[model samples]
Target chain A: MSTTDTKRIVIEPVTRVEGHGKVTILLDEQKQVTEARFHIVEFRGFERFVQGRPFWEVPVIIQRLCGICPVSHHLCAAKAMDIIVGADKLTPTAEKMRRLMHYGQTLQSHALHFFHLVSPDLLLGFDADPKIRNVIGVIEKFPDLAVQGVMMRKYGQEVIKATSGKKIHGTGAIPGGINKNLSIEERDALLADIDQQMEWARGALKVARDYTVENLDKIASFGSFDSNHLSIVRQDGCLDLYDGNLRAIDAEGNSIFDQVAPKDYLNVIAEEVRNWSYMKFPFIKEIGPENGWYRVGPLARINTCDFIDTPEAEAARKEFMAVTDGKPNNITMAYHWARMIETLHSAEKIQELLNDPDLQGEDLLVTGERRDEAVAIVEAPRGTLFHHYKVNDQDQIVMANLIVSTTSNNEPMNRAVRKVAQDHIAGAAEITEGLLNRVEVAIRAYDPCLSCATHALGQMPLIVELYDADGGLIDKKVKG
Target chain B: MSETITFTIDGVKVQGAGGQTILQAAQDAGVYIPRLCAKEELSPFGSCRVCTVLVDGRPQTACTYPIAEDMIVESDSEQVAAIRRDIIDMLFVEGNHYCMFCETSGDCELQALAYRFGITAPKFPYMFPKREIDMSHPEIFIDRDRCILCARCVRASRDLDEKAVFQFVGRGPDKRIAVNAESRLVDTNIDVTDEAISICPVGALIRKKGSYAVPYGQRKYDHEPIGSDIEKARKAE
Candidate 1:
């Protein structure tokens, strides 16, 4: 087979994911897979965008980077500014309020990703007729599940509105502390539906768990590879999405580095910029770029942590780990199961926070000796997010370096794309809609937010193009 | 005391002193002409043409044009509304007015006027010109990007505060409010409690510590329109 006459397949703006991304797969003369690349097409330079802005405005202004995960950016930027303002220790009320907001963000984001983006592929079958493999198809086929997903997402959004003051681009989390406390009326309203939300979350978790268990043989090696897992975990080794120390584990569940302070993240991790992609490749410093690339988000978070804090999610985590005999579940599709476990955990955490009396406390802000530089990280819905800022004497942001979650998972996503391309599309006589969808299914497993990586807007159309080795287009497929 | 002058605004009779402008007479009659640069406590400055109304079949600023006995004024006509809406649109595209994150959003006069006129977005393309912020002052900061060049602060500082802390330093399009000092506001003698600091109709001048202190629905213009307080008096009369 002559590698010179390779056939190329390009999927521009992968659909159902946030932001714009394109996938290019190269095939040899025999149509065997040669290379696959996931390219983040748009770049808005959000890090440079924040420079010269006042440090206090970073939290609110940073939300423009991603519409889907605004709360994550809002809270992450606020945490960094909290240090700049010398609020080393937030009051209990402030801490809990921020946690509640973070959990709400996680629940809603994961719910939207699973029920809307992933279910179409799983329920309709990847090779199902392209016409019915859409939102209308999912609704027409699974009405009850569709309603549950919508209502669950709505409940999480309500929690966000109550804590952050609005559903979108909320200014709830501020430097030092929050601007307002949860009023009694707001608390009562959320409390009314907390139990129902918890029940729905459990039902969602079961859907993911049963699906993963039933199709274990089929999805076990579907775009799956052994890789390092990274996330933040409590000092006691419990899963903590809002606040924790950095941790990383190898494929065999051995701790590579445990309890690394977020402020000292630079020592252990570094990002590599490549000429081909707008997103950066983050990897462990010692292992270097080639092999150090690790997976993040739900699968990694579940793998790296000893146990989840919440009861039901912890039990679910145990069963999830048992699938791989207590080793890191490297099956790419297992991300869905891991994500649902977190969704259930977030719901339970929201319930617990709603019952606490400290939410009504008046002591919100706490300030002390201010620092000129600060670094903060929080587990966003996708993965670990890093926000670093340096302010001058006038409090204007002189420097900003943000490594969004999507950027951290860049290499892993590309690997997943390559694996899928090799398995399904490499030797095919002709590229079918179902085979192309298999590639999308692999990338969607990570739920990569290309918008956050490139700091672009939401909603992108899918365009698949096939070109000959001479760089001429041979076939095309388009979808929204 | 000046002699009383009578006028008809939008087919309604109104009275004012001889030296009073159409805006003054309209206010006395409980009609809001929607002037941004014209504050009750400060001298009227006709920089913002948002109050343009036809006086005797000619367009004139209600804030600057003096009222005369039996003079006819049309403020509610579609032509006048279009002019006001155009000025609002121009003000928006000419500056980097990000109301979503701005502190004085709900309470801002510019925002309220836009809301009242049903202008969700400007018609013209955004300039997005580079702008600078001055946070040298310990208590107050100036985000010049949001400035509409209304000059309310200039008049307030000169007339009410008696400090002359702010003034227009540049020409049209390049125009901006500058402090009394050579470059920075830190050198000026403006206090946090100065009437000029609180008189800004937009987020151009903001207090440092309290951005979004008030929650939604409780801010100054949240419950009603910006001029509803002045308009409510008309219904009572």
Candidate 2:
């Protein structure tokens, strides 16, 4: 449909969000911005496909949900399967090694977003030349910073490869525990890069500090809105991304919920299904969908947490808190800043877990009688990830429901896109590439890991006819 | 004479011993012909039919079709390529080949062929057929859903392993790979270290603890295409 007839602006295949998605802006009859939506159009039926599969195989199977965060899915599935496997508790070796692997994932993914995806928009002005507004331009201009980014990512990937197996779709996490333990050789290799990793992390924190200081006005107002925040935190309210009780805070940083068990997620959170997009809108159960939408990931973790345990990350958190005047930091651009701080925390945590002697222990796995149901949660780089499974007595999976990290931010991401569209394109007669980029910039700030809640359907019903050797009609497949 | 015969495969002259199949001669001459059930050590059963090539304008399996003098073969032509692609597509739909979560993914011949042919979404409908898995053997588990019905496991067992612990049962869609034992994997005579365990071309027969040992980047087909070795054979010339 042409804009002349419908007043619709569609940005098909949104860029830089880990996977394929699109943003659609609707204008009223008077040419005023009415609404905007970001849709994840690629549908994955992992839930349906995993049914009938044995619970022991779930970890490796579910890892295919997203190539960017396969480890996240791997860990979450394994933890849930841990319960299914009837483990009293994960052994010290298993728990610590999994933590190391998760931290490696967080560090690598966050570095990829900052250095590869978001830095171009920040280093270059948002309204800068569209042609030069990419990582290539960022490298062309800031060579040292670009190299540092690459090195930092390399450091994280090295940890992943060492702990798990490979950079993508490693099989470190298993049902009762991991299939293998971190070898002393691999541990020493990571320790060798510790100093370089810290230096790069500090440099990244400085870049974040400089960007925010330089662009205060833009950071404060662009896509800024009040909403609730969600994350997992320790009992003392320290930022604990790997394993902790669930916690949430209101827009004013008041505790909305705390110490919620991972198994009890259903009691506090609910999902709103929409036809336009397959990604479910997750919200606070008590508040209802109209006002319950909350944000997750780095900003939420930093803003809602009482403190970060690591010395350098704790210091960075304090500085960030002062910048936001404490509690509920809603400036979407500051997500980049919070991300850098979390990266530092991940690096420091990786060092701590690596230094622990238990990581090198020979106990790689444990087992017991299998249970029929299990639930597991972890803080993926995107946000809080939940994996729940129900299996029969035979250990065959009967049902599976996964609330991926990105699905939690679905409502807020869409709202940010709308806010950006309304703010930039409302008064303009024609929408330009710069304006479209603004909407993308707002969504990219969340760093959504897409494709978990995406599906496609063919429009205009068509019949596909298959022919045999003699050109005879053999079969017909139809879709609409 | 060195007791060798020469034939043209895809317009290239290839040499092999007498009674050698076209696939064998072509392979020695560095021509790659895709085959599923034609293992080097086993008898060529001509199963799966993925290695079909035109023998002077008539379609025949390159694995069983012996190379003869003055014969013209069209293996890589558009018509033959489409037929090969369709065969793979049908295999995808007929069985539950979920490569996304499969352990044998990077090393799977079917999956590698799909990647070589760029089979993003299959042309056929996903049957999601009701298939049974026999996890009876403690050392080896058989997932029938991912099986392509190739009897590499059967031959590897009977001839190489000499156990005769596996066989094919039924016909057409009802056809399946079966183990010697009736009840469970633990009842089988096969151990985790059997040659049959490593010989299966698919994820149907997998060693319990042998998966995920090789990382993604270091896997067999991670860096190069499956048939690239044959190409390398050609390139080394």
Candidate 3:
């Protein structure tokens, strides 16, 4: 085929995920993958702008990282401050409420991704007429499923709202502990709703399982990459979202590192620069420190965890284990399974929290002297999120750095896109929109929030360039 | 350099600190001015417009007006009451305020002011904006429909909290408050503190996700002035 005969694939202004992004795939003469790029187009410099602010204010300030995972940032920042202040000195009730809210966030966020974002594609079929492929479409096509999804999200949100005071940016979880207390009546109401929501979530999980089995060919043919997984694990060796140690494990279930401090995340995980996109490549510091690539998010979490706590989630985990020879390494399909398992676990965890009698007390926050530096780590709905800050004696922040989960999986996302492009495209026929959508969908499976990942905007051209085997630029495209 | 400005409020002439707002002067003169968004901790947003008073010959929001010597201010003129009623009407229409089933029914500033002004029925049609209840965090709760768009919460985030977590998205009637960085409050980053929660005058902002801890009939506002509640909040802080 002539150089001009090469097919170009473009997915413009990708939807369902946070912020804006585009994916482009270029096919060569042999119809093989020439180059694939995941372009992050928006920038808001949160780290730089946060400098010189008070350290006590970091929890509230960093909550601006992502709307969906503000709790992750707030808790992470608060915990980091607590660590700097000495953790044992912090209030126990505040700690409990923080964990409760953290779990609440995980439940609501994962429910959103499973039902509203990804389910539309799986339930309705990705190419099942774009006109009817949305949340509204989900509602019209499967009203029962839609209502369940809404209720599940509402229930999760209600828990957050009840505990923190507001659902979105709850000021409940502060630096010391929580600032608000739950009443017995509020607890009873939350308890009343949990059983129904859990049943709904279980039904949704079954739907996902059936859909995955039905569309094995389509799902398998999408992007897949093998990489080490990293996530937070509890002392009991169970999957944990809040107040746990970091663990890095290989595909064979071998621990690369465990109980790693968040401050030393730089020693275990390192970021690399990529010229094609704003997202940075995160690599394992021990093995591939220079370019030792690793993956985070739903796939990484499911792959690394030894066992889930909830019975329903554990059963889902067993089902997952049976699929990939005891270790589910197929990253593309992990999105579906992670969401189902997490939803089940979130329901179970929320039920347990609502039953706790101490949640009714009013001693939510405890004020103390401000710390000069702090670091916090929590598993956001996407994956592990890290927030580190340095503050002055006046409690104002001097420097800050955030390692967003999406940015951590950048290298793996690139590899997965390339793999999918190679398997599907043959000899450069016009690259169809359906194939491109699949590639973008694979990235969205991680529920990547580009706004939180980049958090800084600069005048960088959105360019897609194709390189020949000899490193010569064959074709270059740009979108402003 | 201590200058005092005399202004006629209702039928009495009162002297106040120079350059103070009519609301502030009237407040000092023991005249009641109903306001939802105005707070001592924040700069005046003037969005609620509930404190509109007849100043000289024009109806003006007392919160925004600067005091002038010999200026005649009517604290409860018919025009002021009408404007306040209209503002309350707009708030009721924009939000999904089901007063009968609300937790803040008796304690709500909007409801109390409405009752005071004899607004038994909303003259405007209810907008019934499709709002979401965010119970994602353990302590804070947000009802987007109940939000009056006074932006006191937004100002609190910017001024007192300094988080800038709450932001007004879209413009005019389409305006809605967003937490942290997203359109949906459930996903956005916002700290659920008492200061942020109490900043909201309408039922839009409330504490936690569950039913009210203090039962409807037993709420503090039923027996005390709303100002006393502010005093309690200040002491607690």
Best by lDDT: 1
Interface RMSD of each: 1.4, 3.4, 13.6
lDDT of 3 by residue, A1-480 (tens): 233545556555556777677776766666666787777767657888667543444666677667787888878877876655454355555666676787778778877888888877888776776667778889998898888877777777887777666677655555566666667887888888888978987887788777776777767657775667888888766888786778888766778999887777777877777677877777887887554776777667777778888888889878877777786466476677767778788888888777776676665544455456666788888788888788754445678888888888777677777876776655544445465556767777778787788763233333444444444555555543
Supply the DockQ value of model 1.
0.59
What is the per-candidate TM-score for chain B? 0.97, 0.95, 0.87
lDDT: worst 10-residue window of model 1 chain A = A1-10
Pull out the clashing pairs in model 1.
none
Instruction: Supply DockQ values for each candidate.
Output: 0.59, 0.20, 0.04
Better structure of 1 and 2 per DockQ:
1
Q: Pick the candidate with the highest TM-score.
A: 1
DockQ of 2: 0.20
The CA lDDT at A336 in model 1 is: 98
TM-scores for all candidates?
0.97, 0.76, 0.70
Tens digit of per-residue lDDT, candidate 1, span A1-480: 323567899998788888788999999888999999999988767788778777888898898787777899999999998999899999989899999988888999999999998999888988888788877799999998888889888887888888887888888888998877899998999999888888888988998999899999999999999999999999999999988999999999888899999889999999998999878899999799899999999999999999887899999999999999999999999999999999999999999999999999998888888789999999999999999899998888889888888888899899999999988998886768888888889999999998888888655777889888888878788876
Candidate 2 Cα errors over 4 Å, as ranges = A1-6, A455-480, B1-101, B104-141, B148-167, B172-174, B178-202, B206-237
Docking class for candidate 3? incorrect
